[model samples]
Target: MANGVLRPGAVFAGYRIERVLGVGGMGTVYLAAHPRLPRQIALKLLHQNLTSDDYVRSRFELEAEHAARLEHPNVVAVEDRGRDGGQLWIAMRYVAGIDAEKLLSEGPLEPARAVYIITETAEALDYAHELGVLHRDVKPANILLERRGSNRRERVLLADFGIAKALEETTQLTSSGMMVASLPYAAPEAFDNLDPDPRMDVYALGCTLFRLLTGRQPYPGSTLPQLWYGHAQAPIPQPSAVRDGLPVGFDDVILRALAKKPNDRFRSCGELADAAVAALTPVSQLVVPPEPEPQAAPAPEEPTTVEVRTRPVATTPPPSPKERDARLAIASVTTRLSAVQTRAERLEPAFASLKSEFSAQCSADLISNERISSAEIVEAETILTSAVEALDRGDAERALELTRAVRAHLSTAERNVDAVTGRLALLRAVRANPKAKVAEVRFKVHDAQMLALNHGTADQWQAEFDAQLERIDRIAAELSGRHPDYWAYITGLDDVKSHISALVQRMKRERRLR
Candidate 1:
């Protein structure tokens, strides 16, 4: 192995490693060719250090076993797992596209598109939950999006069962002081160290939806303490509050999903996804309006009989062609005016919201080009005014043309406003606390190291490893402090963690030889 990475042409357990797919705290995943088959598989190898630890090894094997039992279309399949040259490995179906986490780098997905991905993930979660399996770690990174065909529509699949547990299993992997779920998306109960359940996954899934909708984590806390505090105490944030133009109903859906109590949340992941779909759907589209009731006939008037008209009542002439044409034009314009009025009324709220958000966003100094949206709104309003004046003047052709222009202008304005809102929201989030995520990821690294320290059963080198861990702890604290560039510290922490993992592996090998 080259620096713990299998080199190209290196065969292990009948699989030939082609290249590294991804590296995690526990292991490295590779795109490997199956010996007996013509297909490629994502082969994940447990770090040599982790394989020497009983708990970590058991958890690795459990991921394959638990995932292999789930046969969901939206769930990634586990092919097999076994030991190869003393390193534990798992083979799974190789998905071709990026995960949802990477997709969010392009910014929040369209509401419909985000909901579609969530819906697919929900089905996969419910499937596993039904089979007595709980994917304790349900975050965007674990949800793979496979874009297919010419249209590039994504096929969403829920993956990474590394921390999943059977319902009947009593083992608590957190015994090692490492949280099974990612901190940003972990449920409140997870911090409480409560028993594992499906609701925990539901809570994580809700957090995922929030991230997808806002391009920000639900809680932007800079420390592990602050993160858990936000989950347990901070009020659930409304998506519309983050990004303007989001449906108000989405707030309710996310609120329920992130409910402090599991029972207070959706009964299942499917229900959560259903609620998201419902939130995206308009109330006007949900049901038909009732027909108006017929008016009751007035009681017959009595004793008011009128005398017959006198003879020689003059006959009236039929309308002239010009008169008829004018009447028809008036009627046609009146109908068009009604339609346009209704359309404008429907858009009025959106325009008002844009105006309000633009005002609020200006104070933040985050959106520099908000003037474009402001000008668009003003121009659209001016066009609408011109359209109304033309209708009042009975210039039907001019009115029709101006009304179409108003609609087109409003359409462009709305699109621009949405773009502005997204940019404003992203900037605001970054300004507030970019280090929260770095803190969260660093906590994971530290937690994993602590877990390893707790499991290092060999006594000869334990004292030396403890001193190294203390040094790492000091370095981790410094990294979490006032760092000018957060990514620099993050990169530093990753290097530190990788070095520690390598040392642990070396210690295990030396102890075994002795």
Candidate 2:
């Protein structure tokens, strides 16, 4: 009924379409049963309109073909790609269970569960990277959680390689000048039209992890432009900062993965995966703590005017060797605590320096006039400096701490830059015209008049205003692209459009638009 339902027995490439599972801008996914294998597979068909565009068709096929070549257990395996009845489709192993987004939306996953999913995904990405495939879109929606049985743990399967780009290889699909990915999860480099790489996947993965822990995307807004600005300017908050009970080490690994610069991130997905695994392990288990002796009770206070004379009591026999060994263990624990304190004191300055440099770079970038500030480059340098200091002092804990701090700073700097750039663009548009003021007054009058006519019900009026605002905003965006100078001259035009669009849509759904 939705255009994807092939008749009950419709067969595509020897598989029968059971039903349509989902549909997107480019195609439809169907649950199909294999003719002889007795297996169910997800079959994706390119939309009819999309196939009319040769570029989209080729890209769709390329993605399927390339993804089919990857054989990792964690990566969803593509079984076949072909056309039937003028419908091009791809068949992949059908994974049963909800996507990561749906699962997280229901509730926060246990920390261990989150770590498990992330680690599995990292391994899958690492494998793809080794094969030279970059999953340009690596958001939570693309990660599927497959639960086979009631007692078995869920398996993480990375899906939707539809936008995956083979590194260093040029394809007709991308050459045709079409944006092939979702903007929300796109890496900063992708925005600059740079070649796709594994680090892009790394940034996306970090964003997904942040969203899972926070119950919201790192940046959320009503509009795409707003979301983009948030991504570009908001700092990555530590998981522990937002949710209580999360381990500090868990925060460190997330921050590291989110490092603005690719070089600053873990050298590879493998490294990141390993770090995640390590973070999930209890620190007490990894590092043995010295055993401390039970504290002795304090002596009772003597009353005033007590007799000064003291009676000698019989002395007990000396402790056995076992007792002596026990005492030695207590001493050892004391020595270990002292050593820990001493090391912490010595490493304090190095850590402080790392933090200072990271902060300074962030500040400079936020205030600078560069078209594109290399926050990643700055972050990478900080990470390297911290790594060197850590190695020099042979303190892994200190090094890890420094790495996390730099990562947090980097995430914040990148977001800030985006926000500032978007706002600056808006401001510039506002300053260019006198008529923009007149347009604002006219729009406000129209809004007020409509409100009065609707019996002063602000909701009804607000709905109308939102629709107009969306239209104006779209027009202004287009104008900004063509006439940057004229954007500032048209005040209230965009705002009016956005507000009106929102209101109208709401009213229409409520049957009040008539």
Candidate models: Cα lDDT each: 0.65, 0.58
Per-residue CA lDDT of model 2 for 413-466, tens digit only, reads 434343443334334434444335445434443534343343335654655555
RMSD of each: 20.3, 17.7
Stretches of candidate 2 off by over 4 Å are: 1-8, 49-51, 164-181, 281-514
lDDT of 1 by residue, 151-217 (tens): 7777999876744332112233343234434778988888765555678989999999999999999
Q: Once superposed on the true structure, which residue ranges of model 1 sit more than 4 Å away at CA?
A: 162-181, 283-514
Give the winner by lDDT. Answer: 1
TM-score of each: 0.54, 0.55
